[model samples]
Target chain A: MDMRAAVFRGPGEIAIEDVPKPALDAPTDAVVRVTHTAICGSDLWPYRGQEDRDVPSRIGHEPMGIVEEVGEEVRSVAPGDRVFAPFVTSCGECEFCRKGLHTSCVNGGFWGGEDGGAQGEYVRARHADGTLVRVPDRHADDEETLQAILPLTDVMGTGHHAAVSAGVDAGSTCIVVGDGAVGLCGVLAARRLGAERIIAMGHHEDRLALAESFGATDTIAARGEEAVERAQELTYGGANHVMECVGSTGAMNTAIEVCRPGGTVGYVGVPHGIEDDGLDIFGLFMDNISLNGGIAPVRAYADELLADVLGGTLDPSPIFTKTVDLDGVPEGYRAMDEREAIKVLVKP
Target chain B: MDMRAAVFRGPGEIAIEDVPKPALDAPTDAVVRVTHTAICGSDLWPYRGQEDRDVPSRIGHEPMGIVEEVGEEVRSVAPGDRVFAPFVTSCGECEFCRKGLHTSCVNGGFWGGEDGGAQGEYVRARHADGTLVRVPDRHADDEETLQAILPLTDVMGTGHHAAVSAGVDAGSTCIVVGDGAVGLCGVLAARRLGAERIIAMGHHEDRLALAESFGATDTIAARGEEAVERAQELTYGGANHVMECVGSTGAMNTAIEVCRPGGTVGYVGVPHGIEDDGLDIFGLFMDNISLNGGIAPVRAYADELLADVLGGTLDPSPIFTKTVDLDGVPEGYRAMDEREAIKVLVKP
Candidate 1:
């Protein structure tokens, strides 16, 4: 069967084109008819040619949809069930997956990088039982709720991972370094996790406002040393937990500088400019700071975050400042790249 | 009163000379008449001229001795008490000290770097209640026990810090990246923490044997990729906890390469060659590994470690392969720098 999907032709080029609908390739697979999807900061990496890719490939990994078909072995999810698919697909039974580090699952792979992308009208999900979370009945028919849920696939989950990895908990003083959707999401996550003081550092006033609304106790519209100085002044010395959501070297350094001695920097930005050099080992060692983080195990955190979403306590949809259909995804990418929108959502 | 002490004349130079005996400088200070002290691997930094120093400075930080006098405010210790002083002096009431991170205490200072060194007839200890741990009665009168206890002030405690910072616990597979005294002590610390398998990597057979004696289950006398390969082969992939006890770039890289995805590298070797270049941040981020550690908070761990020593469960004295009087310290530094001794004990 034919379906409409977003295809990446090259850097700065994406087109909605006719594609073959995905079918259940294995007994553990399920095909979902995408209802909503969104653009991610990571999607811009390949779009901007920062990350190399094969041309004319499927694009996008953040999608919420209704299961259209399931193989005989798929017992937990079935046709007509509304669900959220994590960016990474996992087998659920590997040592890493069983330990709740689904991102490191032995048999896991990314939605677009290793398999078919989720921007299509219908996409096949492998390890269906372990990769998809069912949407509750109360929010099943609500488009806004579904739009908010879309980000949990990658951005929100990733931000949550950053906060948790940095040890942001009750009484923690945290500073998030970035003004993007994920950074805003991180502010929300830190608040949810009970951080006592949340400092959001960014240049854009609009995004900073969004951050404050999402529970940032303070905002510093500065970069580099000034941002670090502001954070240090706000926290008396430096924050106990720092979240680096921008992959730039300066942002990473700022995160490190603004962290208190014995603090942790949880980095979730897909690193781009840090190939030739690493962080200052001597400085980090002298401060007794810890550097930790990676791609979020979204599958592991989806259920708990979903509880907060369904409970009506979280409304992350405000991050979707722009909306587009499958055909307008090209413009959606441009809007995000140009900083005109924090995130863009698509209704297929 | 005049007393003899070792003084650093310049790089690669030391001399025994008469100096005024230390007097209590603060209300919380105590004067220790040096009975036993040891040279540290860190001491070689200046002795070998790798590190610059101000001429004519006292030069040591690891010492244990009889408490000759205590300031009026000192409550926990008094004259005649035998104690082990940590390398860092901290005010017990500071936030960092109260949190058990004495090394980062607001009013903390390095014994040798910021104050008078320990290889002297008498040394003043600030914040005595927080920086010094009293030696048990049975071990106080025994010179052999005192020699064993001396290492806990720095080398052994630093190694223990590496293990703990790397999250070494029961059943963990660990690797120690150097075979120096501190690395050998790391093997002991890992074993004490219940690590299932301890791999000690180095080129020296003598130090490797000592590592095995200290509880290393495996030893790899190789460097770089060969070291990583051997570690991978033993752990089936990579070690869960890696203790980086060598500050060399090659050893640090090997430590990073041999760590399992999601594992940690606890580095305690005062970083030297890593100033211009850092670790591979992209690689570390992708692998989900964490880097943590710093100078050991010996004061925090000294009491617990001393219990193991007095209980006869640990004997770290073998690390002191040579002994010298105060006048022989210059030769002791030369012996250590020339690789003739693992560590040197100084009887003042």
Candidate 2:
């Protein structure tokens, strides 16, 4: 079978090509027919060559699909099941999975790192029972809403992990140090977790407004510790929880600074390692704050978030401001890279 | 009232002379008649003039005394009460005291730093209700037991804070990366917190034995990551909690290496700053581990520990390997500085 797929040929250039369709290989694997996919900031990372893509590779990590075929070992679902796959693939029975730490499973590989791509009409997914979350087919009419739900595969789940890892509790005051989709999703997670106050920091008016819509009680229009100072002033003394989403030393510092003594700072940012000021052990100790947070175990949250979306408890659709066909996915990356769009949804 | 006390006239020498007795001050303060005191490694830092210290300073930070006089507002205890004062003085009215974070209070001051000494008889204590814990009068008969309890004022509390900050839980493996008094105290704290297996590292056999007595189930004779590797071997993979009590860059690195993926580390050692290696952030994010711990809020835990001692639940007396009179306090510092003694308890 011939399938349309978005292939990243070079920097700022992606092309829709007719690729061979996927087949179920592993007994626990499934071949999904892609219906909705979204462009993440992480996808833009390779598109701008910030993460350096040398060879031609498929682009999307956030995608929801219909399981057209499943291997004999797949007991949870059959043909025609709608599901969202985790950004990382994992074996169901590893030591990590037993502890519900699926993201760092020893047997798992990340989508962008290896194996296969999700930005295609048909893609092979291994360990289907563990990696894919089944969604209701009735919601297919609202693909943007479903596409929004797809980010639960990575960003939204990651945001939740940040808040959870930092031990954000009821009535906690939270400071989110970035205005990206992950940070905005952090605002959503903080709100869901019952945080009393959320200070969203970003320079862009659009992103800040999106933060407000997602449950940021206040917006700090500054960056770095200046933003932290604003959050501290608004929070009275300091915030109870701080989520660092931007992978920079500046953002990391602000995350630590905005949190009060005995508070916890959950940092989800992947630092590029320029100014590594995250080495402030002295300050962290003297202030009596706990710092934690890292890669999100998306597989752990997929089923619950899918149920939440279908139940109408959360509508994450507003994050997707633009939509593009498979061929237009290349321009979508450019738009996101240039800050012209918040998020882009890709229909295959 | 004339009292015989040690006066630090200059570096390298202290004179035991008749000094005017300390009297009542603030309504919330108390006058403590010094009975037993200890020479800390930190005290040596000032005594040898290795640390920036004021000459002619009365230099003692660890002491247990009897309440000779209590101000009218002192409601926690009355005159003739046996007590132990924390190294840091804290005002209970501050925002920090409300949250039980007395160490970082605006009105908090360190003993023998900007605030004068506890070396004198009838020492003046500010905010007495918040800064002092009543020692059981029964334990006063056992001078050695009380002497061993002296380190609990600062070192023990600091170590406890390290483990507590890292969130040490039951049935977990922990690694203590220093064999100093605080590190040995960490062994006790980790044991009290229900750590199933504790691995302690140091160069001395006597200190190692002390660690074993204090509840370190295993001992590693090496330093740095080699010690960490051995701890990992003993614990199967890595420790769930790691305590860094040695104030050096090498010890910090050891603490980082001994922790498991998604584990927590508590560092109480004052860091000397070595920032070239990006290992800290890398271990934190890539492994999803967290690092916490700092200066111990001694005032917060003194009462509970005093209760523990009084209730016969804990015996911390084995830590005091040497005891000397007030005149021998300076010699005690020299002994600890020269590594001839594990800890020295001074009786005034």
Candidate 3:
């Protein structure tokens, strides 16, 4: 079957092409007919070849789709099921999966491309039974509104995980470093978790505005040391929870600087190695601050977050400030990479 | 009342001087007749005048004594009660107390020296109800055997808290950095917590051997990166939990470095103004290793550890390698600071 697909020919290049549809490869596998896919800031990483794009591989990991085909082993879902796929596909049985740490599952890999990314029309999801969460049928017809749920597949879940890992709780002050979609989502997660104060650090006013909408009680546009001091001022010394969403040396430094003594810094940002100054370890050790966060266990929070979306208790859509057709996927990547949008929704 | 006390009349000069007996000041305070006190590694920090010693305060914080007098407000312990005093005196009603973080309680303060150190015949212990844990009456007669328990007042409790804070549990592997008494105690604590594997890292053969006796399954006599690599090799990559008990920047770094992805480094080491490399925020972000620990909530773990000592479930006494009369207290400090003794017990 010929399916319209967004093909990444190379870095900074994308073209609409007719690609062969995905099929059931294993008894636990399922083929999701793409209904909604979202452009993630992470997507920009590979799109710009900054993440060492495995050439010719489809590149997207946030999508909601209809279960057009279900393997025989699948029991939780069936054909015609509306579902949201977790970014990383995991086998139901594994040490990591047993502990609900799906991202680190030995037998599980991500979805979406040939390497299991989600940029194409038809995407194969391995370990379909444990990795896919059924979406409500009501939101199926409103793909635009429901499209926002796609980011929850990775970004929203990631942000929530950051807050949870950092031990953000009621009465705690939280600080989210970076103004990207994940950072904004972190602010939302902090608010939902009942953080008394949420400080969103960003250099962009527009992004800061979006962060405010996502429940950031305060925003600091400063970078580096100044940014940390501003967060400290807002939180009456330093934040109890610091979420590092931007994967950079500076953002990492900001997290440590802004977290209070006896607080925790949950970092989900993938770091590019930087030299050790010996100060971070000293602060972490002396202050009793817990630093914890990594790959998001998307499946862990999928059901709860999806229920929130269906009931309208939470709106993650504000992060989607731009949208583009599958054919214009390259431009969407450019917009996100250039900071033109917090997140861009892609229509398949 | 005249009492024989180890007095630091001046730097490099300490003599067993006859001093006035201690008195109870607050209603919740108690005056303990010190049966045994410990010369802690920290005690030397001031004894050598490396720390402020101008006030000529008492020089010991680790001690086991009999409650000679109890103020009117004292409820938990009365006169004649045999007790172990936690180094940090806490008011059980404070916010930190409610959360079982007694070491950092709002009204919590260190014992010994300026206020009331245990290096004397009689010592005043403030917040008696919160700061003192009455030992089982059975062990009250065995002062020598229980002298080992003296270190539990500070070092042992601190190590145990380090393990607990890092979330060490059954089937987990842990690395203990530093071979001091506290680090060895941490090894014992990790073992009691059901950790399957414990790696003790130190440079001295004697200390490493002591660590093994304390329940360290393996020993790595290396420092810095080599130490970390040795621990990782012993643990088959890395440990699930790392306890940093040395209270140095180097130990903290080693603990963080040896922890596995998704592991946690519980650091009880009192850091000097030295900065960490921010490994907790940046380097460990992708590894998902959390850095957690600070001043251990010694009050929280004292009862159980004390029980372990009484029940023969744990023998923490080997750490008390030497015992001296009040007159030899200065030599005890020298032994510990010079890395000659694991822990020195001082009897007044």
In candidate 2, stretches whose alpha carbon ends up further than 4 angstroms from where it belongs are A1-25, A43-60, A119-122, A224-226, A326-330, B1-25, B31-35, B41-60, B67-72, B77-81, B93-95, B118-123, B247-249, B274-279, B323-338
Q: Please provide, for model 3 over B1-348, each residue's C-alpha lDDT reduced to its tens digit, 9 standing for 90 to 100.
A: 678777666665666777777787788888988888887776665666655675555567776888989889888998888898887788989756887777657777876553556887888888889888898787877865586677678888888988987789998788888888888889989999999988888889998898887788889887677777777778777877888887655666677678776788887877643343233444455556776787777888887887778877877878888888888887887788777888888878
* TM-score between predicted and true chain B, model 2: 0.89
Model 2 interface CAPRI class: acceptable
Error of 2 at B149 (Å): 1.9
Error of 2 at A48 (Å): 6.3
- Most accurate candidate by lDDT: 1
Mind giving the per-residue lDDT tens digits that candidate 2 earns over B303-345? 7777776666666666677888877876777788888887787
- The CAPRI-style docking tier of model 3 reads acceptable
Candidate 3 TM-score over all chains jointly = 0.74
The candidate, 1 or 3, that scores higher on DockQ is: 1
Root-mean-square deviation of every model:
2.8, 3.9, 6.0
In candidate 1, list every pair of residues with a backbone clash.
Answer: none
TM-scores, chain A, per candidate? 0.97, 0.92, 0.93
